[model samples]
Target: MSISTDHTQLQRQLYLLGYSHALPSDGVVLVSTLLKDLQASLDRVKELEASTVRLEREERTTRLGHDKAKGELHALRTENNSLRAEVLGHSREADRLRRESRADQYRLSKVADDLRMANLQLKAESAELSRSLGDCQRRCEARLSELDPRGKIPRMTVNRPFDVSRLQTHKTQVQPAIVDLVDLSSRRISALEHEIEHLEDKLSTSGVELKAAQMEVKERDLELMRMNSEYERMNPAQDVGDSQVPRLTDQVDYLHERAEALEKEAKDQREQFAKEKEDLHRRWVAAENDRVAAGDASWWRQAV
Candidate 1:
């Protein structure tokens, strides 16, 4: 019994020592698995740090782009302001030019009206001058008629002196002859003085008439010039009355030629009638001779 109890105690002691040794080996394996897990977590933290740095750089780039867009917008606004100021200045200049043009047009119209009035006054003066010239010409003609010598003077006649001398020898005839000679000489001197006065009056009248005629001619020339100018302004194709003048002249010439031809035909007809009458008279004479010969033969047979 004492030896069996000692063997059982030795077996319990060996079993307890084996269990302690197995517990220590399990603890070492658990520590090795924990170190491998810690190494994997450190690698993941390094990757996260690199991603944060990239995100910060992208945000700085976006801020620079925004500043550049603002600068360009400010430049465009300044250019638009300069263009608007130039347009306003041009509008003011255009309005000033329009006002000046209207004033010039009004002045030109006034000048034209003044010129028309002046022309009318000149025409009235010219017509008055023409009438005065016509009156002067008529007075001159009356004076010229009085001055002509052929109608005013008379001729003188003389008688023979032999009979007067014979009567003088017979007494009182001598005294009468002397008285008649003195009276004839006095009458001749008075007639000469009257003729000289008449001639002077006629010459003065003729000079006045000539001056009036010259003035009339000048006025007519001016009127013709004015008519010519008006005709040119109107753009006339031909002169007044010119076209019909030639036609009237042609008609006159035709009438003259036709009358000459008719006169020649009448003269020829008269000549032909005279020739026919002469031929009929010769035939009548021959027939009368034949009748007389037949009557003579019968008379002769009765006498035999």
Candidate 2:
């Protein structure tokens, strides 16, 4: 038979045994002995039933707990999968940002290099213009010295006869060359100034871009930090569930031990009861034999 069926049969037998021991007896000692045996048997049966009930309750509770644990595990796994995907996405974004930042840095470095080259070119041009101006001034001084041998041209200007035609020709030729040299120098300076301004503007723009890049990096860092904080909050490695497993395991073990202990106690009580019942049965048999022997003696006397 199945275990449940056997248990049911045992329960029925125990009930029948209890009822049989409760039968009315004529002798007080017999009634008392039967009552005691019935009570003891009932007590043992009650203990066994109680153990069965407790074990059943524990088994039901364990099943419920196992189902709950499985549900929680499934939920955690789903959450872990989502978090892993988020982490991967964040990692990819971080990598992309790093690459962009590197590219920006390279561009900014190139702009700086261009600015440096422009400054160097401006310096060289300015130096060349200065040298040209000095050379032109020296040449003008040499021509003036050659034109006035005694260096008395200014002193004799008021006393000499006025040669307007010769003076006009000299003025026309010399003034144009000097004006041309000054114009050329001015144009060179203007071009250098324009180039310097352009370089300055580029440098300023580069600085702004760098600042923006830095700000972007900071924002990304903050975003990553927020994501990390969220991840930590959502996905705790240790929680109430972690402790609950061991606690539930301990409870199950305790229940098992209690059931085993109850079974052992029931077995010992049954053994003790069996010994007492055997002794009582032996005494009852001896009493019946003695009553029969006495009746037989009495009948024999009557017959004689």
Best by lDDT: 2
Off by over 4 Å in 2: 1-46, 145-304
Cα lDDT, model 1, residue 236: 36
**Alpha-carbon local distance difference test for all models:** 0.46, 0.54
What is the TM-score of candidate 1? 0.30
Q: Which candidate ranks first by TM-score, i.e. highest?
A: 2
lDDT of 1 by residue, 217-273 (tens): 445435544543443344335743553344355446545654655575467556545
Tens digits of per-residue lDDT for model 2 on 132-164? 445556777778889877773332223443322
The per-residue C-alpha lDDT of model 1 at residue 256 equals: 63
**All candidates: TM-score:** 0.30, 0.35
